[model samples]
Target: MIAIVTVLLAFPLGFFLHNRTSAYVVYVAIFGYSFTFQTLYLLRAWVGGDHSAFSADPEKLPLDYLAVTGAIYAVGFLLITLGHRLGAKRRNRSLAVDLESSK
Candidate 1:
């Protein structure tokens, strides 16, 4: 539940700040924190006391949560990289045109 929400929020926030590289760095840091926290939560649930109450067996633990988090991070990072590249290209083209016009 909380993990899902964190992923949802991180993606858009990352995408929105993609124009700047600094924002992408921050996004990755946040994603890392969320991933570590969620992983710890799963480990605690599986290995801590009352584990059987949380899951009938160790194999039943929700490993897919980690996979989902990785996928979201990959997608968000890709989007931010693409956005930065596109922005840089546009800025370069505009500068080129301005230089040509001056010449």
Candidate 2:
């Protein structure tokens, strides 16, 4: 259920920013969500007397999940940055041609 919601969010997060200039927004958001979950998980576990981090308390604080999320975020940033650069190059080329023809 959490995965489903995260996946749904990733699309717009991947799509909307569309450049390295704004890439930090997504990265920050990604880390923020992870931190928020971790904080809540720790609070709940502490309050319930679930001390051991390695214990099977079902809080789902696995390292692999963080790795996967970071990987996805990096790939998304690269793709979006590439798209922005390509679009900018194409636009500049067209504008240059227009300027040359006008001169």
Model 1 segments more than 4 A misplaced: 1-24, 35-59, 95-103
Scored against the true structure, residue 57 in model 2 reaches a CA lDDT of 53
TM-score winner among the candidates?
A: 1
Q: Estimate each model's TM-score.
A: 0.48, 0.42
Worst 10 residues of 2 by lDDT: 1-10
For residues 1-103, write the lDDT of model 2, one tens digit per residue: 2344345454444455446456556655765676578657865876687765434555667676467656765655565555556656655564433436554
After superposing candidate 2 on the true structure, give the runs of residues whose Cα lies further than 4 Å from its correct spot: 1-19, 30-61, 95-103
Model 2, residue 87: C-alpha shift (Å): 1.5
Structure candidate 1, residue pairs in collision: none
TM-score of candidate 2 on Cα atoms, chains taken together = 0.42
Error in Å for residue 70 of model 1: 0.8
> What overall lDDT goes with each candidate model?
0.61, 0.56
